[model samples]
Target: MYKIVKPLFFSLNPEAAHHTVTGGLQRFTKIWGAKSLLKNLYTVEDKRLEREVFGLKFKNPVGLAAGFDKNAAYIEEMAGLGFGFIEIGTVTPRPQPGNDKPRMFRLVADEALINRMGFNNQGADVAAGRLKRLKNKNGLIIGGNIGKNKVTPNEEAVNDYIYCFNALFDYVDYFVVNVSSPNTPGLRDLQEKAPLTHLLNTLQKLNEQKESPKPILLKIAPDLTDSQLDDIVDIVRDTHIAGVIATNTTISREGLQSEDALVQEAGGVSGKPLTKRSTEVVRYLATKSNGAFPIIGVGGIHSAADAIEKLEAGAALVQVYTGFIYEGPALVSDICKGLLKNK
Candidate 1:
């Protein structure tokens, strides 16, 4: 079904195609028996697929990464596609319209996407509300990816993160702190050693106060140096945070086959171009820390082989966003099926 519709979707503008696909799915599921039909076609259920990570049980290790359903609106719809988990939001304490039009671009030639979406989301409260109202998550683990508001100054960024953390605390199973997005001005600056430590420590301190604290993971960038990653390992150890998401997106555009026009687009690049580097990052973190913490590998995972590479490289689980767009809905089942064969 997705193969039949791929061309039509690819013909639309990348961002428009996204809205159309998601909106269309929202509408399609309204039909009688559609949800179960989709589940039977797309979901791969097996006892072997289950994974336990960070004190939570996942039906599988394949997750829908942050940014795909930024506002938590598609949890139920996306859940039908058979992801073990779905992360919503690069959400903020307060809502803000992200970067202007054409913020998302497709490098079809490279099976990649460049987005400067600037964490455009409907705020933490709204996402929390949606999660609160979601009737049946079907055992899907949900993660809340939190970030500062665009207007939040770097000096006070911790406050912004804290606000979002508190708001979504009860709704999400885990939390991903996003301080590495290139689209957010000065946001990556927080990734520097001192500030990053401060932020995580603060969040961790608050987390400890809770009766049932959730796991907190740091989302890092692929551009970090080995020394910086060493710092990341140290920070996770010091703060006692849950783990790390190997990479967010890369700012470096080294080898892209797309036209210079699209390649030069100002934003973070995701998809195939990120494959090697993201796996490299995952391996580095896993090796550097001696596998001390879990790493959720993402970026450029268009197939189960790609997902397994990361898992072998030390990622406990993996995620897909750009790959889902390029590979269509069946990518989820294909990946799970591959894992079963390989396992």
Candidate 2:
């Protein structure tokens, strides 16, 4: 069914097609029988698929990555699609329109996508309110991925992070600090050692103050050097962060089969081409840290083998975005079933 419908979605503008599918799912799930129907078709329930990481029990280790559901809008719909978890937002303290149009592009030949979304989202308050209204999450773990507003200077970035963190504290099971996206002007600069340490430390302090604090994880870019990754290990240990989400999108267009014109677009690239590099990053962090902390491996995970590769590389959990777009809902069940088979 997805294969048949995919061409139609592919015919539309990349971003438009995204809204069309997500919006449809959102509405469809609201119908009386739709949610269960989707679950019956896509969910693969088995005790063997359960995974416990960072004090959270996931029905399965496969989760939807952050950027895919930037707002907390489609949690129920996504929950029905068999994901053990769903992450929402690179949400800001305040709403912003993000970058200008043509911000998302697809590299059809490469089965990849390039996006310069720049943390565009409805404010944190709005997402928190929506989450508050959600009555049934079907045991799906929800992670809040937060980032600074584009207008907020890097010096005051901590305040922005704190605002979103506090607002979402009561809502999400865990949090991801995003300082890796390439589209946001000067955003990646926050990934430097001093600022990165300070940011995670500040959030950790706030988290500790909570009566029951939630886990905090750092999301890093694949573009980082080995030395930078070493710094990340130290920061995670020093700040006492929960774990690391190994790899956000990459700015590198190193080896893409796509046309140069599309490849040259100014955005972070994600999908098939990212498989090897992202796995390398995961292995580096997992190996270098001696598995000191957990790692949520993401990027280029499109098949069961791809997911198991991440697990073998030391990812406690895995996430999918571009692959979900290209392969459709069946990918989730395929991965879970594959995990059971391998086990």
Candidate 3:
């Protein structure tokens, strides 16, 4: 069904199609028994998919990656589509038009996407409000992936993160600090040692004061070197954050099967070409962190094999973005069931 819908969707602007599909899903579930209807198509509840991390028990390990439902709009609908978890936002303290429209593109030839969406989202407060209304069930876990606005300069980015952290604290099961996306201007600079440590430490300090501190994880880029990853290990240990999501999108264009011009389209590359590099990052982080921190692996995972590869690489959980777009809802069940099978 997604294969059939892909052409029609691909015909529209990537961002527009995204809203249309998400909005449609939101409405689709409102009809009587619609969720049950989707369950027949996409649902799979199996023990192998159950994962425990950061004192939270996931119903399943396959989570919809952040940036898919940036505002927490389709949590219930997507949850019905068989993801054990869904992460929303890279939301900021304030809403802003992200980089201009053509910012999102498909490299279908490579089963990939290049997006400079720039953390475009409704403010954290709004997303938190939406999440607050959702009836929490043990079946799904939702993570809030937070980022600063493009207008927030690197030096003061921690304030923006703190705002989001405080706002979303009660609503999400976990939080991902996103300083790694390649889209927002000067955002990646926060990944450097001193600044990165400062940001995570600020959040962890705030988290400690809460009666039930949310699990905080840092989302990183695949472009970091060994020394940088070592720095990340140091940051995670020193700050005592929950874990790391090893890897956001990558800036690397190597081995892309897409046209040269298309590959050169400016943005972070995500999908098939990202698999190896992302997995490598996951493995590297796992090795460096020495199981002291958990990892949520994302990037280029499109199948059961791909999902398992991340688990084998030491991911406590895995997320899908472009793969979900290209392969559709069935991908979730496939990955989950595959996890069950191997177990």
Candidate 4:
């Protein structure tokens, strides 16, 4: 199916192709049995695939990472293609248009994408409202990946996270604090030890106040040094957040096979170029923390073997974004099938 349409999609610009697929999927769902057809073709159901992580039960460990469905608009559409979970947003307290045109570029040769989207999303309240009305999410675990608006100053960043956390609290199963993305200006600054610790601790304080506190996981960047990773471990322990998502994207461009122009384009790189580094980050976090907390491994998961490698490195679950694009919708079921085979 994807093979047939891949070329047509590839013909359009990266961003346009994205909108085309998402829009097409939205219209596709209007047809009766469309969802059932997708499920039968793409899903692999089994008792063994179930995962219980961070006080939440997932039908499988495979999840659609943030940035794909930023507005929570396609939970039903994506759910039909079979996913244990779907994370919505890198959304902010207020909607922002993000970076200028040509912000997203496809490196087809490298099977990667470079996006400096700068947290282009419709705001937490809009996403929250959409999630509020989402009805087809039967067993799909939803995660809210929250971030501060680009215009929000670092001093007031805590308030941005607070607004998103409180707004999406009722809708999502878990929360991901996104201070890792390299796109947003000064956003990654919060990933520093002191500010990062303060942010997580503040959120943790609010979380504890609730009768049922949900898991709050921190997302880190691949560019961090060993010393910084150590700080991450300490921060997690000190704040008592749920776990970590080992890596958002990389700012490095060491050995990419893509052309110089695309390679030189500024943005975080995600795809085959990141596979080894991402797994290394996951392993580092898992080992450094001595498996003290769960880790959601995400970065260049293109196949089941990739997913398994992340798990073997100590990730409790794994997510896909670039892989989902380069490999297609069947990638989820393929990974599930591979997991079943390995089991």
Q: Which pairs of residues have clashing backbones in candidate 2?
A: none
Q: Measured by TM-score, how close is model 1 to the native structure?
A: 0.99
| Candidate 1 lDDT, 1-343, residue by residue in tens | 7788899999999889889989999999999999999999899999999999999999999999999999999999999999999999899999899999889999989999999999898899999999999998778999999999989899999999999999999999999999999999999999999999999999999999999999999999999999999999999999999999988999988989999999999999999999999999999999999999999999899999999999999999999999999889999999999999997
Best by lDDT: 1
The global Cα lDDT (0 to 1) of model 2 is 0.94
| Model 1 pairs in collision | none
| lDDT, candidates in the order shown | 0.95, 0.94, 0.90, 0.93
TM-score of 2: 0.99
Q: Which ranges of candidate 4 are over 4 A from the true structure?
A: none
Output the better candidate (1/3) by TM-score. Answer: 1
Tens digits of per-residue lDDT, candidate 2, 1-343, equal 9999999999999999989999999888889989789989999999999999999999999999998888898888888999999999989999999999899999989889999988889999999999999998878899999999999999999999999999999999999999999989999999999999999999999999999999999999999999999999999999999999988999988878888899999999999989999999999999999999999999999999999999999999999999999999999999999999999
Listed per model in order, the count of residue pairs whose N, CA or C atoms clash below 3 Å is 0, 0, 0, 0
Model 2 spans > 4 angstroms off? none
In the range 1-343, model 4's lDDT, one tens digit per residue, is: 7899899999999999999999999999899999889999998899999999999999999999999999999999999888999999998999999999999899989899999999999999999999999876788999999999888899999999999999999999999999999998888899899999999989999999998999999999999999999999999999999999987989999889889999999999998889999999999999988999999999999999999999999999999999999999999999999999999
lDDT score, candidate 4, position 4: 93
